[model samples]
Target chain A: MKIVAIDRQGKEHTLEGRDGWTVMEILRDGGLDIAAECGGACACATCHVYVNDGWFEKLPAPSESEIDMLDMALAVEPNSRLSCQIVCSETTDGIKVTVAPE
Target chain B: MTAAAPIETDVAIIGAGPIGLFAVFELGLLDLKCHLVDILDRPGGQCTELYPEKPIYDIPGLPIVTGQELTNRLLEQVKPFNPQFHFNEMATGLEKLADGRWKLSTDAGTTLIVPVVVIAGGAGSFVPKRPPIPGIEVFENAGDGVGVHYAVRKMENFRGKNILIAGGGDSALDWTINLAPLAKSLTLVHHRDGFRAAQHSVNQMRELEAAGKIKFHVASVKALHGEAGKLASVTLAGADKSEWHHETDAFLPFFGLTIKLGPIAEFGIHLNENLIPVDTAKFESQTLGIFAIGDINTYPGKLKLILSGFHEAALMSQAAFHIVRPNEKLRFQYTTSSSSLQKKLGVS
Candidate 1:
């Protein structure tokens, strides 16, 4: 699957994501500077990003715990999501997200 | 010191984790003064608190070592430096002072001014997990009133007050045992009979309960009764039919520990994701006079292993010396080969 991550400076990163790897892993492997702290535990909000508008509704709703951590994320938006929660798949190809500021 | 006055040092390290501890040795060898601030009340971060008894296999030459033992060795290794520590505090505010030095403050209101700042926080600061109940903060926001409390900032504040503590963790059980004699009345409430705290603490809590020194209830906080920001009464809903109102002046909930980037998230330094992005050469952040190491930082081909952080700390110190002592020429020497380095360690 392919995904795009736009950094704070507007640098676009196109990444090849393996099926089992998360969007965070793909972004990190592409050297796009995603924290992914606590790895994929979903405990930390450092992996926060804003999903593109039309794609936001296509994804599953954020879990309660993820929502709780998202509340602590900086510059949270309605489309905000944790990249750790977004595992890569064929359905998620072409997913576009903007990395949230720390 | 209060917020108005700042503590002066050559370096201010943001964490007291393992990597942060090692940085003290590197910076100390360069004759730079250092002060470390951490959210944990003690050193060793996760190693000491989370898995003190767990055996770690990957710490270099040691065949195997307990987490606490490893932490102890590191602390002993850095003892000669006489590094000062400010525990139970999070680095909150960061800025560049007028004279090109950095000014940083903690959640405890302690301020630090230094030419170089090192961030070694592992996954940022540890934040306590709060109960999911709504309106709990309203009482917590009441400013040390009856309804809610998270941190026991001042033990004296609860003296002679009726206190209710809820949780099955170590903190809840320990506080129940500690405050039973001091409080006018103390109650330990949990959702179930089983607890995850130390067996001794659980036994002591039970002993106090049996002796009538403290009350124990197997129930959950269903609702709160308080007005004007003060907690008055708490309703406990038991598994049985009875829902009872327990009168209390203060409520302390100790759910567990969770990590958050905390105030570090607000610093003006550009973050690659939630991490401090640093140059591989010096591990310095994009901001001048500030360097980041350990798991809290990210760079190209970065590895988060503890040994990698140790490597980053060494490089960070050489760069830090340039900022702390601009006029002095750096003399790089190995502890294994240099008598000066061995003498600094008191190890020859």
Candidate 2:
């Protein structure tokens, strides 16, 4: 799948991912500065991001732990999602997410 | 060749938490002596104090274990050398003696002389800040603070219990989502209807509420009600001065910790709030012979993680060892040499 990650500096990177890979893993492997403090256990909300419009429905719902983590995140929005909670799938092949201002 | 017995050991560690415990293991393997000290009655720092009952899934080599259990395993892992330990005494300050040895003062009025000091305090030493609301102190006397908590590690504590959560941040929202399933009833209160959490988390909370799993309150907690020294209900007031009461078994507030620069600040250590500025390569603070590890130290691209802290501790300890013993041979040895010595004594 093709995913585009826009950082806080507005620099965009188009990365490739396998089906079922979380956005967090893709960014981390790409050496982006997304802080996944809890290592994607959904225990800490350090990997939050804003998904582009119309992409929210394509992603799966977050777990309870992910919600708890996001509660402590900064600059949260309607489209905020823990990147670790967003799984890549056929319908989400061209997902666009921007790292939130931490 | 026999090792020379110097006037002092290599490093002195403050705070025997996970990071400190790991420092001992790393330093011991490097054939250095570490004197570990803590103000707590026992070791393990925050893991033993705050979340001892909470299960930790992150640490390697153990699929899952309680915080207290992890502390025990860490203690066991570093038990062979019998590293010097001092407990129940807080480190008050550090003084540079005329002889070049560092003098550390404790709250108990004891002074310790060491060459180097490593601070590995996790989010343990700092306390969570209580929300500043008018008449909030009234709840403190009625044991409302007892049921109201800041950190959520064990779901059992809130399981089958009616819970009310406050805040729109990630921590507050995360707990609301996690506890919705286990709690008999869950109520989430945020200052604004819009959340500052992950979009997916907010979506999940909305889904749970729609499915009759939880309730949301877009207001701030105004007052806490109690009778006979236990929480009875919480009163929330909206922006329009409307108030509502909801009976709850417990109140879980996920507001983040209010961190301040502690004792290290007195020594002229340069810092921004609780974070210490450092050279990413050396991990050295503004003061010589002093190093800050874990979340306390900040750099250009530093990501605070337990694993990253482990790496920081390893790097800092090696540099500390070198500072104390400039000419000493630096070797990479996995197992501590003391273990072999103990095996020879049949103590293993």
Candidate 3:
């Protein structure tokens, strides 16, 4: 599965990761600047990312707690989602996202 | 006399929670000495504060253990390291010293110069949650230090005064029982007759109330009245909203605690909301020589579990080793395989 992440610097990097691991794990393993503070528990908004327009709708809707955590994320947008809540799967192979500012 | 010199160490750890205590073992394995600072008067953090008797099931091999029991075992495991502990103080500032070592200062004026700083504070520092009493701040102790008090820093200050202690928590009950004889008259105020303190403490409080030594008011504090910032009387509202003025000299509200990012926010490290962001490999923040583990830190795919913090501590200690001793080579060894490490643990 290939997932692309644009860091705070706007430099894009494509990553190949296995299924079952979260988008957060793929991004961190791909050596990007993502802070999944609560470690995929949907407890913190550190792993927040702005999903590209086309990819945002394809992902599952965030839960109540995820939305609450997103409320605390800085620079939140309509497409903002906690990367840890986005698990890796076949449909999410070509997703694109931008890392939120620190 | 000149002020005492700041304490120095190889690693200055914040928070003596389970993760902080575990970091002592991991860092000790690498021969890195550590000094811990925490805001609470006691160690164990949430375990002791929130739930001491509640059984936890997910702590590795321990099938079913209470929070306090787990803390006790961890304390025993790390005892061989002899880590220095600074309790009842909050780490308030972090600055780069002239010699390249970091100088960390606490609220109590204790300072320590450490080459590597480890933050294991679980959800940051614990700050007491102030009750929602209108204008209570007005009587929160003025020039002579008498009126409203959150914590009894000095029990002697309330001697021979009419004291009104609110809330049903341990702090309220403990102080109610301890300060009964000291105060001219004491009143235990709560919304209901039930209390959250230990049974022994509650029973002791009841005994005092029965003997008419201390009055028990099944009510809540509504308003404070005083002159010159001195507490004169407190209006207690009953369940039916019936208010009555009770003559009191001092008011103490022990409403419990809420965690805050506190002074660590001033450390100049990158913060995601309130947690420190770190690299998964080293668990070190964007800043060099500073590591964050436990619930205090954030990374991609981070889990706030104690087991995860324990894993992070091991990796963080490895990364901290180089910064602490640049000239020495790091040789990884297992406790089961390395005899020297076993000797250090007093097991060999």
Q: Which candidate ranks first by DockQ, i.e. highest?
A: 2
Instruction: Residues B1-348, candidate 3: write the lDDT tens digits.
Output: 233489988999999989999999999999999999999888798777656676778899999998799889989999999999999999988999888899998878889999999998888777765555678788875533268887887888888888888877678899999999989999988766776567899899989988999999777787889887878898888867788999988888876565677889989999997889999999999889889998889878887788999999999999999999999999999999999899989999
lDDT tens per residue, model 1, B247-278: 99998887656677888888898897689999
Instruction: Give the per-residue lDDT of model 3 (tens digit) for A1-102.
Output: 889899989999989867988888899878897756444556446677999969999998987667655534543456888998898899998899999765
lDDT of 3: 0.83
Root-mean-square deviation of candidate 2? 10.9
Residue by residue across B1-348, what tens digits does model 2's lDDT show?
A: 232232355677777877788788777766668877677778876566545767877767677888789889888878764678778666667878787778776666556677788777553244444554444455443332246776775777677788888888767778888878888889988756777677999899999889988988777776677765477787887756688888987877665543233566676677765677777666788888877777778888887656677788878877887877778877654443656645632467
Off by over 4 Å in 3: A1-102, B1-3, B141-145, B198-212, B226-228
lDDT of 2 by residue, A1-102 (tens): 888899878999998977888899998888777866545666456678999968977777766656656666544556789998888878888889998764
DockQ-wise, the better of 1 and 3 is 1
Q: For all the predictions, what are the DockQ values?
A: 0.05, 0.17, 0.03
Error of 2 at B243 (Å): 15
- Model 2 misplaced stretches (Cα beyond 4 Å): A1-20, A27-33, A72-78, B1-10, B14-17, B25-68, B79-97, B103-113, B119-165, B168-188, B191-216, B219-253, B256-288, B291-340, B343-348
Residue A68 shift from truth in candidate 1, angstroms: 24
Highest lDDT: which candidate? 3
Best by TM-score: 1
Q: Rank the candidates by DockQ, best first.
A: 2, 1, 3
